[model samples]
Target: MITVLIRLLTLRAENVIPEVIWALMAIYVLAVLVTLTSVWVTFKKLEGRLLWSLIVLLVPFLGVIAHCLYCLTHADVDVLKQFGFFTRKTA
Candidate 1:
């Protein structure tokens, strides 16, 4: 069993990660990063790091909407100290 594992592990790296897969993965990661950054910037300071991060990372697009709604509803955190949809116009 060890020999079989060793043989597979020794195979060429190119065969393991195809070019198209790599490109797609890079794009996906970039999108996730951008989305996460947007969430961070929009909220200014997110309370309960674990819950917010999980919501954003787990659901991607829908997570953004949910987080925005959460920001609107939750009053504990300063959701208007930075880039908020309503705060900018009133200022």
Candidate 2:
């Protein structure tokens, strides 16, 4: 098993860097789109323009994660209340 794993690792090392970079780029784009969708949905639900611009300007994957965490945990109950959408409720 160890020998097989070592062989596989050696083989993968030959082409893994480019493949990993491509995957990261794809994930980044997907994250950006998800963030944009989240912001749009949030705006549509809440009828406010508070964080959309700021979130969109951030680096994609990290930005989406940040926005999601903030929306889920922050104490802005009024926003969630106004939209009738809470993370816990959705879960």
Candidate 3:
């Protein structure tokens, strides 16, 4: 049994399975959907929401990846500050 397992593990595949490809595609689609939903929910203004939605929809995979990186880097700062979406309060 151990020899059989070792032989199977040592074998290399020449082609990917159709089911595996479909599963991967499905997962990617799901991720895009969830990311789009999060973008809509996170940005309150209509303009900001529309801009981000267009970005994610137009660029697909790269848009989501870029957005993820942007969020990670700016986790502590006001993301919409540059766009003048929010006004600063003076004490």
Candidate 4:
């Protein structure tokens, strides 16, 4: 089984096109997964499912940018505040 697997890998490496195509497909799948996860997490945080979904699907890079900005601006304040975090101190 090991030898057979090695032989298959060797053959695949000999053909650069197939390897390249496979790499591209893997990268595309990874990017899609990352984008979907990002959008889902952002939606969960923002509670704006429909609107954010549309924006994420239609605008490339913008979804990620929006998510990052939202996280940066609100994550520490709003989200954390819910869990008794970032409470104000009385003077």
Candidate 5:
């Protein structure tokens, strides 16, 4: 098990495509940035902000998806508006 992990970690330079590697890294950075900003802006309480920040940072893509799902189902419209997510005027 340990040997397999070490082998995976020690990837040869020849085996990787530089463009694809940079693209994936860029996507990850963008995702983390957007998710962290969303978490900070949407949650009013400090603990909520901190907890979601940690979740998104530590868990990667799945954490961003989870936070989005939670917000869609659980967040108030006013809160989302406060975060500048909703811009259309309400009747």
Candidate 6:
């Protein structure tokens, strides 16, 4: 195992493309999973449901984080209001 690890660490520059592609594919799969889980739990209202769902499916990496933050703030307005500094009420 250690020998294989050493060989990977010494990969030539030309071999990096396939490795990068695989890494990106893995990240995309993870983002899809996150988006699916969010659909099951977070988004309920019909307002931005389709829009946010598309965003989560299309943008790489940060889409999941964005969806999660949206869900967080939407679901916990009171929690944020308790902090006072974290929430601004619109007049």
- Candidate number achieving the greatest TM-score relative to the actual structure: 5
The runs of at least 3 residues in candidate 3 whose Cα sits more than 4 Å from the true structure, single-residue gaps closed, are 1-14, 77-91
- Write down the RMSD of all candidates, one decimal each: 12.9, 8.4, 10.3, 9.1, 10.5, 7.6
Pairs with backbone N, CA or C atoms under 3 Å apart (clashes), candidate 5:
none
List TM-score per model, in order: 0.42, 0.49, 0.62, 0.40, 0.63, 0.49
lDDT of each: 0.64, 0.65, 0.74, 0.64, 0.82, 0.69
* Candidate 2 residue-wise lDDT at 50: 47
Worst 10-residue lDDT window for candidate 5 reads 1-10
Residue-level lDDT tens digits of model 4 in 1-91: 4654455467665445554567656776676567667667656655576667666567766765675576667665777789887898789
* Regions of model 1 farther than 4 Å from truth: 1-17, 48-50, 60-91
Clashing pairs in 6: none
3-89 per-residue lDDT for model 1 (tens digits): 544544677554444554566577778766766775666554557555677787988678767776775677434555555545545
lDDT of 2 at 33: 74
Candidate 3 per-residue lDDT, tens place, 18-76, comes to: 55557668889888888888888777899988888788889969988977886666664
Off by over 4 Å in 4: 1-32, 41-47, 77-91
TM-score of 3: 0.62
Task: Give the poorly placed runs of model 6, Cα more than 4 Å off.
Answer: 1-20, 75-91
lDDT tens digits, residues 9-72, model 6?
Answer: 7775554555566866887798788776777566577656777767777886677888777767
TM-score: the better of candidates 2 and 3: 3
lDDT of the structure predicted as candidate 6: 0.69
Q: Could you tell me the lDDT of residue 38 within candidate 4?
A: 67
